[model samples]
Target: MKIGIGSTNLAKIEAVQRVFSENDEIISVRVPSGVSDQPFSDEETIEGAIQRAKKALETTNADLGIGLEGGVTETPYGLMLCNWGALYSKTDHSPIIAGGARILLPDEISERLRTGEELGPIMDDYCMRENIRHHEGAIGIFTNGLITRGEMFSHVVRMLKGQFIYRMNG
Candidate 1:
């Protein structure tokens, strides 16, 4: 079946591809609707994702349409808030919603990020000891030996995939 994904991020694409690989019947996955390169607020992210799926379905006429959106949120509580949502539409245009983990950002980094600075660039500028994923690695200079983008994205994708399946069957 042809599936249309709604983001240009290669990591998202790779995650979808990995999930689909397990189901050989899925013939293709393409991103037909992409969002702006800039970051979107939490509500905008979900709305944009839904809009993209709708647009992709209308344009591609695929068997399924998928939308993934990432957002950074702040809470009054001590925990950091970073969550992403997923939308899946069937051929009939019915949509299902899913989401990934709320990866916490350090208070200091989150404060800077809230000021509209891009995460990676901000990290690089500040010369943090952690990577973007707030992990350790080659990107560790900024992350302070925390997590890599790949690792974070992998976890997000896994959560999303599980949620997708749950929504599919639920």
Candidate 2:
């Protein structure tokens, strides 16, 4: 089966690669999330993932398209890190959706995000590393490397794959 994944971000692509079979050909195509560069809410973030999956499916004409999106949302506990994933297929009008773990952000990082600065650059400067988003990502940094961004998204993709399989069978 041919799979197309939206976005060229290594972390997102890696997640899809980890969940799908080696027999399935996975390719990355750059596509817009159709939302804010930094999604500030769960609704927006999920919408972005869905858009990416739909666009990738159409763009590549692949049997399946995957989208993984990371963002932050405010909560009573604190602003938290959130990631969402979507699996879109030709036979289904609605895509399979799933979400990964959420970790509370430090007040310092949350402060920066509230000011309208994106998390990618904020994390880069906080860690003094460039392109952290494509690497370990905010989840990795916040979790002290215990939970990687790839692993988090991988779990989400696995859920998407399972649901899609069930959807087809049932």
Candidate 3:
């Protein structure tokens, strides 16, 4: 099967690759999120993922398309970093969506995000690293590398793949 992934981010590409067989082709394409660079709500993030999946599928002519998006959401405790993944099939109009690990950001980071700063840059400054999102990400930094961004997204992809398998079998 050919799977077209919406984003060319290495982490997302690697994550999606983990769930599929070696024989299956995984194509990575750079696509827009169709939302703000930093999605502020769960609904917006999910919408972005779905839109990306549709675009990727349409562009690649693949059997399936996958989209992964990361954003921040305001919670009662504080602001949380969230990631979502979506899968789309041409035959099935309904998409299968799943979410990755969510982590509460430090007030310092949250404050900057509230000021309209994107998380990638804020995390780079806070962690004193470059492009942390493309690497371990906030979850990895907070968890001491126990849970990486790729791993988190991979889990969500696995869940979406499960849904696809069930649909195919039933």
- Top model by TM-score, which number? 2
Q: Write the per-residue lDDT of candidate 2 for residues 1-170, one digit (tens) a residue.
A: 99999989998899989988899999899999999999999998999999999989999999998888899999999999999989899889888999989999999999999999999999999999899999889989888898888899999999999999899899
Q: What is the C-alpha lDDT of each candidate?
A: 0.53, 0.92, 0.92
Per-structure clash totals for the candidates: 12, 0, 0
TM-score for candidate 1: 0.63
Stretches of candidate 3 exceeding 4 Å from the true structure: none
Q: Best by lDDT, which number?
A: 2
Candidate 1 residue 26 C-alpha distance from true site, Å = 8.1
Question: Between 1 and 2, whose TM-score is larger?
Answer: 2
Q: What's the residue-level lDDT of 145 in candidate 2?
A: 94
- Residue range 44-79, candidate 1, lDDT tens digits: 556655666666555566666666555565566632
Task: State every prediction's TM-score relative to the real structure.
Answer: 0.63, 0.98, 0.97
